[model samples]
Target: MKLVAGNMLWTNINKIPNQYNYLNESITCDVLVIGGGISGAIAAYYLTKSGVNTVLVDKNIIGYGSTSGSTSILQYEIDTDLHGLISMIGEKKGVKSFELCKEAVYDIEKIINDLEDDCDFSLTECFYYATKASMVSSLKKEFDARKKHGFHVEFLDKKDAQKRFSFPVEGGIYSKFGAAQIDPYRFTHALIAKAVKNKLKVYENTEITNIYPKEEHVLLETKNHFNIQAKKVIIATGYEGRKYIKEKIVHLLRTFTLVTKPVKNFNGWFHQCIIRDNNDPYTYLRITGDKRIIIGGEDEKVGGINSKMSNLSNDDLVSNKKYELLLNRLKSYFPEIKDIAPEYQFSGLFGVTKDGLPYIGEYKDFPNCYFSLGYGANGILYSILGGQLLRDSILGKDRPELELFRFNR
Candidate 1:
C-alpha cells in the first residue's frame, strides 16, 4: 500500500543516505526478509549478526515507506495504557510486554553504538498527562502501576504539571527511563549498510509476486519473474503482509503529523521532552535534535470500517483538514512560539493490534516463514524485539514470551 504521503520530515531532512539494487537475477539464501523498511532492516541485521545467510527485499526504495513518515518516538509505554493493558491481558504478560519494549530501546542504543553512528538517536524523558479532571484518577493508577513495577517515574498533579507545560494537565506521568527518539530513515539505512558489511544482501524495488511454501523451504518470485529460494522467509512488511494471512490481527489507520519551524524557545515545554496527553485519540509531540517540534495524532481508520478497510492498497486517502487541525492543535498547545508553522506535513498508514503488541513468531500456514510485524505506535522499538525474537526462533531457542503476541492469541 501507499505507506505514506506528503513531504516526509525524515527523508526530507536527511540526504538519501544509501541505496540498494533491485533483484535482477534469481538467488537463494538461508533466510529471506520480505521488506526493506525499518523492521526488515532490523530483522536482517539480527540474522546477519548470528552468521545466518540473509537477504532483504522491498517493493519500494529502502526506508522510503512508512519508516520515513514515522515520527520515530521511542518509548516503553504501549499505545494501550499500563492499567488498560493489564486489564486486557494478565498483569505479568502485559508488564513483560512493556519491559520487552524497554529492553528494545536500549538494544537500539547498543546497535547505534556498535555502528558508531548516532543516527540522531537520543535518550529522553516522556510525559503522559490527563486532559480533563475526570481522567486524573485513571492516570494516577497508571503512574502507580509503573512505579510499582520498578520503573523510574514520578507522579505530577495539576499544579506541578502546569508548572512544566504550556497546556493544562489535571495529572500526568513523567517517566524518567526507557524513552528515546531517532531519525528512523537514517537508522534503517544504517542498519542495512552495516549488515551489508557483514554479508547481508539487500534489494530494493523488488516485489514478491507469489510465495510457494514447501515442506522443506519456501520459494518467492519477484515481479521481474526471477525466483528467490530460501530455507526461511521473514515477512516484515508491516500491515501489507496481511495478504499472506487469513486471520484479522490489526486495523489500518492513518495518522497526521507536522514538523514546525525551529524556535528559539519552547515556552513551557519542560526539558522539551516527549509530550502526550489523555486526549481520546492522543496527540504526541517531541523536540528534534534540530530544535523543530514533531507532533502527530488524529488517527482515522482507513475506509472507516473493518470490512472496507481491508481492501485498501496504495490509496491516496489523506485528509487536508486533518493536517490543518493538527497544525492548529500544536498552536493551541504552544501559542507563544512566534512564527511557528509546519514546514512539513505528512500522513502514514499503520496497523494497530488489539493489545498493542507486535506479532513475532512462526505461522502454521506459512511454514518455514515468520512474521515480525511491528504494528503499533512503538513500531521501531517493537521491530528491535522482533529482530531478536525471530533470530532466536530461527536458531531453535525456546521463547515463551512469543505466546503473548502469537497469531492464535
Candidate 2:
C-alpha cells in the first residue's frame, strides 16, 4: 500500500538524526519487531529496556511511513466520542479506555523527557466544538458523559466559546491537560537511538517477506534470504499488518493535512489549543511549535489510489483541490490570521477500528507473536499503551486492561 504521498512536513522539516545498518547475515533475538515507525520504536524501547533481546527492522528509513505524515495531535479523546463509546461497550469499559489513553499521554511525556533529545513535546488543551447549531445537544451530551466520568472538562456555550476563541461555535466541550503534540519523526529516531545504546538491534532498509510461527519460536525471512529467529515477534506494521489477520478489524481511511508557514501572530486563537469539531469527517487544526497552523480533514474511504469510495461524487478529488478546501475552512474558522499559506501538504492512510480502540495483544492463532496495531486518530498514544502492555505480557505478567483491547474482543 502507498501509505503516504506528497511533501511531508516532518520529513521535510528534519532529517534522521541517527542511522542504522541493514541486516547482512542471519540473526536471532528474544523478540523481533517489524516496521520501524513509532509503533515499532515504542515496542523496541520497552522490550529492550526490560532486558529482552530485541531486534527492529524497516523496509525504508525510520519514521518514513505513517509517522512522517502524522499530524501528531496527542489527545485522550478517541475518534469515538465518550458518549458513543459508552453506548458501544458499556460505561465501565468505555471510561477505562479513555483513562488508559490519558495515562499514555503522560507516560509518553516521561519517555520524551528521559531521552537525550527533545522532540518538541508540549502539553496543550483540546477543544471539541460543535460547528453547527444542530449538533449542540449531542455535543452537550458528550460533555456530560466526559464530566460524569470525573474528567476535567468545561461545558462551553456559544457565548463562552466566542469569548475565548475568535471563531463562534454553537457549543463545545473544553478539555484541559489531556492533550499534547510532538515531532513524531524526531521522537522515533531518538527512541531507537537510546534503545540501541541499551542493546536494542536495529536494521533499516531490510524488508521481511515471510513470517513463520513455529511451536517454540517464530522465524522471519527477509527479501534477501536472510533469516531472523526469535522467541516472539511483534507486527507493528501499522495499516499494512492487515495482511496477517483473517478478520477485517481495521479499515484504512485516507486523510489529508496542510501545514502553513509560520504566522506572525495567532490573534484569534486562544492558547493555541487543538481545535476539532463534531462533524463526521471533522476538520481539526493545531499549532506547531514554529507558529505554523496545521488544518486537516476531508477523510474519504479509498477504493484505490485513483478510485474513491462509491459515495464520493467526484472522481477528481485531487490534492490541490483538497488543499484549497482546507485553506478556505481555515479562513472561515479564524479570519484574523492573514497572508498564511501552506508550506507543506500531504495525505496518508491510517487504520481505524469500528469501536475506536486499538488492537494490542497476542492473537490466539499466532502464538508467541504479538500485534501492536494502534488503529485510530490517537495512534501515538495507543502505541504507548501497546508498548507497556506488550512488555508486561512478555514478562509473563497479567493485566486486566489487556482484555479490553484483545484481538478476540
Candidate 3:
C-alpha cells in the first residue's frame, strides 16, 4: 500500500534528515520489527537499549509513511470516551487503559529528555469541548467520570470556555495534565539514530512478503528474495499491519489535515493548548512550535480492506473541497488571526478499534510474533506504551495490562 503521498508538513520541513541502507542479503536477529515509523523506531529503541539484537526494515523511507502525515497531538484521552469504554469493557480495565496512556505521555517525555532532542515535544493542556448544546451533558458526564478516577480535569461551562477560546464553547472538559505535542518525523529519526548507536540494525526499501513461522523460529522473505530468521517478530506496520490478521478488528478511517502559515499572534488560542470537539467525526486544532496552525478532522471510512489510500487524494475536487472546509473551520474558530491560510494539506489512513485502545501483543495465529498497531488519535502515545509492553513480553515477562488490548478483546 502507498501509505502516504503528499506535501507533508513534518517531512517537508525536515528534508529526509536520516537514511539507512536497504536489506540485500540474509540476516538473523533476536527480533525483527517491520515498519520504520514511530512505532517501529520506539520498539527498536527499547530492544536495542536492552541489549537485544534486533533488525528493523521498512518498505519506504523511514517516517515517510503515515508518521509524516501525523498531526502528532499526544493526549491521554482515547477516541472512545471513558463512559463509553466502561460500557464496552467495564470500569476497572477501561480506567486502566486510560491510565496507561497517561503514563505513556510522561514516558515519552522522559525518552525525549534522555535523547537530548525533544523533537519539538511540549506538554500542553487539552480542551475537549462540545460544539452544540446537546453535547454539553455528555461532556459533563465525561468530566465527572474522569474526575472520579483521579485525573486532573475541570468542568467548564459555556461562559468559562468562551473566556479561553476565540469562539464560544458550549461546554467541555479541560485536561490539565498528560497532553503533549511533537514533531513525529523528527522524533522517529531521533529514535532510530539513538537505537543505531545502541546497536540496532535498520534497513529501508525492504518489504517483507512472506512469513514462515516454525516451532522454534520464524523466517521472513523480503520482496528482493532475501531471507531473515528471527526468534520473534513485531508487526508495527500501523494501519497496514491489518493485512497480517485474519479477523477484522479495526476500521480504516481516512483523515485530512491542514496546517496554516505562522500567524503574528496566536490571539485567542489559550496557551496554545490542544483543542478537540465532541462532535461526531470530531476536529482537532494545535499550533506548531513555528506557530503554524494545524486543524485535522473530516474522517471517512474506506470501502473495503483492499481500498487504496494515498497521502494525496486521487480526486482533486474532493480533496480541495475537504481542505477548504478545514480552512474555513479554523478561520471561524479564530477570526482574530487575520489573513491566515493553510500552506500544507494532506490525507492519510489510520485504524480505529472499537474500544479505543491499540493492539499490542501476540495474535492467536502469529506465533512468535507480536503486533504494535497503535491506531486512533493517540497513536504516538500508544506506540510508546506498546513498545514497552513488547520489550517486556519478548524478554519473557508478561504484563497483565496487555490483556486489555488483546486482539480478541
Candidate 4:
C-alpha cells in the first residue's frame, strides 16, 4: 500500500543521523521483526532487552513509512468514545481498554527515559469539544460517564470554553494528565539506535516477499533472494499486514494533515492544549515543538467507498484541497491566529477496527508468529502496549489481559 503521499513535515524536521545496511545474505535470530517503523522498533527494543536475539527489517528507510506521516498524538481516547465502547463491549472491558491505553502513555515516556534519548516527548492535556450546539448533550454525557468512572476530567460549557479559548464550543470534556505528543520519526530512530547498541540487527530496503512457517521456525524470503530464519516472527507492517488475516476486522481510512508556519502568539489558546471535535470525521489540532500548528481530518473512505484510494492519480491536487479545507477549519476555530499558511501537508492510511481496539496477540492460522497491529488514533500508545505484551508472550509468561486484543475477539 502507498501508506502516505505528498510532502511530510516530520521527515523534513529530523534526520536519521545513523544508517543501517540492507540485508544481503541469509541469517537467523530468536525473533525476526518485519517493518522497521515505530511498531517494529518498539518490538525490537523490548525483545532484545529481554535477552532475545532480535532483527528488524524494513522495505524503506527506517521511520520513513507511515511513522513519518504520523501526527503522534498520544491520547487515551480512541476513535470510539467511552460510552460507545461500553455499548459495544460491556462496561468492565471498556473501562479496562481505556485504562490500559492510559497506562501505555506513561510506559512510552518511561521507555524514552530508559533509552536516554531526546525525542521531543511532552505531556499535554486534551479538549474534545462539540462542533455544534446539537452535539452538546452528547458531549456532556461523555463527560459524566468519564467522571463517574473516577477519571481526571472536567466538563466545560460554552461560556467557560469561550472565555478560555479563542473559539467557542457548545460543550466539551477537558481531560487532564492523560495525553501526550512526540516526534515519532525521531523516536523511531532513537529507539533503533539504542537497540543497535544492544545487538539488535536492523536492515533497511529489505522487503519480505514470502513467509514459510515450519513446525518449529518461520522462514522469511527477502526480495533480494536472501532468507531470514527465526524461532518466531512479528508482523509489524501496519495496514499492509492485513493480508495475513483472513478475518476482515480493520477498515483502511485515509486521513489528511497540514502544518502551518510558526506563530509567535497563542494568546487565546488555553495552555496550547490539543483540540479535537465531535464530528464524525473529526478535525484534530496540535502544536509542534517548533510552534507550527498541525490541523488534520476531513476523512473520506480512501476511494470514496469502493475504489482503491491509494491508486488514485491526482494525489497532489487532492492533498492541496484537503489542506485548504483544514486551514479553513482552523481559522474558523481560532481566527485570532493570523498570517498562518501551511508549510507542509500530507495524507496517510490508518486502520480502524470495529471496536477501536488494536489486535496484539498471535493468530491460529499464522503459527509461531505475533501480529502487532495498532489500528487507531492512538497507534503509538497501542504499539507500546503490544510490544510489552508480545515480549511477555514470547517469554512464556503471557498475561491474561492480552485476551482483550486477541484476534478471534
Output the lDDT of residue 322, model 1.
74
Q: Model 4: residues >4 Å from true position, as ranges?
A: 303-308, 312-315
Q: For model 4, how does the per-residue alpha-carbon lDDT over 1-409 read when each residue is reduced to its tens digit? A: 5688778888998766778899999999999999889999999999888888999999888999899889999998888889999999889888888988899989888888877676888899999998699999888888887888878999999899988888778889998878999999989988988888789999999999999988899999999999899999999999888889999978887898899989887877899999999898888989988899998997767653345676433256766687889888788777787768778888888778999999998988889999999998999999998899999999999998798899979
Root-mean-square deviation (CA) per prediction: 2.3, 2.2, 1.4, 1.6
Candidate with best TM-score: 3
- Tens-place lDDT per residue, model 3, 164-277, is 889878998998898999999889999999999999999999999999988799999999999999999999999888888898888877788899888888888888899999
lDDT per residue, candidate 2, 1-409, as tens digits?
5687778899998976888889999999999999899999999999988999999999998999989989999999999999999999999999999999999899988998879977989999999999899999998898889998999999999988888888878998888879999999999998999899889999999999988899999998998999999999999999888889999897777788899999988888878999998897888999889889999998877765455442223224576788889988888777888868878888888668999999999887898899999999999999999999998988999689988898868
Error of 3 at 59 (Å): 1.1
Candidate 4: C-alpha RMSD after superposition = 1.6
Query: Could you tell me how far off, in angstroms, the CA of residue 396 lies in candidate 4 after the best superposition?
Result: 0.6
Per-residue lDDT of candidate 1, residues 246-304 (tens digit): 88888888787888888788887888899988886889999888899988888877754
Name the 10 consecutive residues with the lowest summed lDDT in model 2: 307-316
RMSD of 3: 1.4
**Candidate 2: deviation at residue 202, Å?**
0.5
Report the Cα lDDT for residue 145, model 3.
91
Candidate 3, residue 294: Cα displacement in angstroms equals 0.3
TM-score order, best first, reads: 3, 4, 2, 1
What TM-score do all the candidates reach, one by one? 0.95, 0.97, 0.97, 0.97
